[model samples]
Target: MTNVASPVAVVTTMDGRRPYGTTVSAFASLSLAPPMVLVSLDDRSQQLAIIRRTGRFGLNILSTRQAALAAAFARSGPDKFEGVAWSPSEGLPRLPDSAAWIAAEVDDYISAGDHTILLAQAVTAESAEGSPGPLTYHQRSFGTHTPLAP
Candidate 1:
């Protein structure tokens, strides 16, 4: 398995009422046969704990302009969503600037060394008016998406 995402993924879940840690990393689909996607979160992360207990999560594809959001979520974190602008639907926290957002139900969890693999079924989705591409994590820093020439 390769350790890279099509673009960095931002995972969010509610903490009682407030949104906590927006996790960003190289995440991708684990199985199309079963409609499954996986995200790797550190074992000690609050996001992992919330996902396990609530059994639901949202995957938000960040647009290139959302580099700050990506960095706020990706770097060594603590209350990552502190000042981020977002709203909630069915209790799922949504970042409005995301290129696309998908809501999912936890199907299973896999233990992979330092991280827990969250395998979930994408149940609902919304497409935002994106500026262009997505936020990419590469070379130990964050990168923005670029539009290719026709």
Candidate 2:
């Protein structure tokens, strides 16, 4: 999937009083009527394990200026949010100034190869009015999308 451009997002949830998150590019809208989305996580991801226990999560769609944040969350560590700026929304970590945000509850889990796909129903969704274009990943690099002239 390296050739395919995918939006970068951080999946967040609370493990007790602490916040857990992971950067992911395997996220996509699933339905409009019910406002659902799909996020694929490694079977062994600790974030996934937390979501299983809490059944709730938040999706922070990173803006172009937030590529560093994405890289930080992608690492395996307890201090990913050590100096990060965020707040709690719907009891999940909310990153400020993101391109978009979605609070969701996991509706189902599907095992696929080495990853488990979380089919979630969006409980709330919002977009920043003047946020920068979404951060994207392609060819193993981080970038942003540009619209083509009509």
Question: In candidate 1, which residue pairs get closer than 3 Å at backbone N, Cα or C atoms, i.e. clash?
Answer: none
Alpha-carbon RMSD, candidate 2: 0.6
Query: What is candidate 2's lDDT per residue for 87-119, written digit by digit as tens?
Result: 999999999989999999999999999999999
- RMSD (Cα, Å) for all candidates, in order, is 2.7, 0.6
Locate the minimum summed-lDDT window of 10 residues in model 1: 1-10
Q: Write the per-residue lDDT of candidate 1 for residues 29-62, one digit (tens) a residue.
A: 6766666677888898878898899999989888
Worst 10 residues of 2 by lDDT: 76-85
Alpha-carbon deviation at 26 in model 1, angstroms: 3.0
Which stretches of model 1 miss by more than 4 angstroms?
Answer: 1-6, 32-34, 145-150
